[model samples]
Target: MFEKVDPQYLLEGVDGFIQEEVSYNLFYLITGFEEALTIKSCDSKVLFAQSPRGNPWLWVNRDLPEEERENALKLLIEYLDETPLTGVSSEPRTAEMFANLYGARYHTSIKRRMDMEAYACPQVVKPEGVSGCLRSAQLGDVETVAQYLAGFSEDGYGIVVDPASQMEAAEIMVCKGGLYMWLVDDRPVSMAQIAHRSPRHGRINAVFTPRNERRKGYAGAVVSGLCSILLGEGLVPMLYADMVNPASNRAYQKIGFIQSGQISDIRFE
Candidate 1:
């Protein structure tokens, strides 16, 4: 039923879950390259809803009636009820009670939204015998950057993948930016993005450093550089740190990032 988001995007999330051979160039109507909530309705109906800081998040877009959206939700739930699922936005506080908001009912029981940010910059933390440089990422750097992301750990956020996660993961990374900087040998040790649709918002993403390269200031420098890039573009950068990783959060605070509020989400049958 999906008509807009490239089917390839939808399949990537699916591949992440099924861990099977994924075919490309497939577009989905509602679900795109990111994971879509997989639900096979046994008892309760499920919904997949989307929210954006703005319009450009959707590459090719369309709109449907509120009732149509609701029906789509009901159908999607019925279609994929057996699968574990997730949504990608900060849930509204009153989300659970609403029958329908954007395109789906607010599922209060679903897991809370993972951290999304406007932009974030960590305070300066000087590292001895180290130097860092930041700049926008380019096509030439994709292989190197991909290698770094391939090794990034969710650090305890429950996001993990084997060697198989490469394709879909890579596709999502491409939508990001050609503007990322690397530290030391011009390899991207940390990478983030300033949102295109929102002038005041930025997102820190794919901030990875090789395991052998951890504890150095490369991460901070790369993120700080990305923040400066966003600022230069006249935007404020925002990002989320794992509540569990006090060190990561603290590093950001040292570099001038502040916590506005915690984001929570949920789902229901």
Candidate 2:
């Protein structure tokens, strides 16, 4: 049987598991969201969380017998009876299973949105010949950061967002001191942000290089430099790469990030 549980309950006994399967960091981080809801099986072998701002996420203990796992998923679907969900994200197989069942019950269509790979870096291999230094993004850099943010959205998702639309986010990130820029001769060339920090890992995201700055090793250099900083703080650096973006994935691998696992994002229409 599955029942609603406190979000904090989702973290208990899962620290080591999350450390090993870094892909589930989404599950770890979502619990902190203000409107997050969590549910787990009676034995706590299967877990699910929903965030008001994003798709629901599920995590089933992989060591369970296949039959047991399937049964738990079925119970979870029943437990969620009329609760509305637009999509689900989880390990590929689990997300597929839940999406299939959820769609069948709601008579909705299921679509795979994105195939994402989680990577963790144990070391940093700074790109050679990249003549840039990594520095914190300042308030004065908000406009540049906004442009890069807009470019990242367009390149990563094919969504043409106006740079002005990203100004507030750029200002907030800069004020948070988590955004970093790679500067060459005092000109910003690339950018990345330490999006979140968990117990033992720091998540990196929003990595971007302007179109004119591509092929100059700025992206790799900035990420490598950020990874070094995270490592110095005793946290492993991790990020998710869209499988369709081979260039970005290659750049990350070149800097010593190893593929830890895959997660599927599935939408119900």
lDDT of 1 by residue, 65-102 (tens): 44653555455544434543443232233233222332
Q: Could you tell me the lDDT of residue 257 within candidate 1? A: 82
Candidate 2 residue-wise lDDT, 19-47, digit = tens: 44589887767888757889877777788
TM-score of each: 0.53, 0.94
Off by over 4 Å in 1: 1-130, 153-160, 171-179, 195-197, 267-269
Candidate 1 similarity to native, TM-score: 0.53
* TM-score of candidate 2 relative to the true fold: 0.94
Please, what is the whole-model Cα lDDT of each candidate in the order they appear?
A: 0.45, 0.87
Evaluated at residue 88, the lDDT of candidate 1 is 28
Once all C-alphas are superposed, what RMSD does model 2 give against the true structure?
1.7
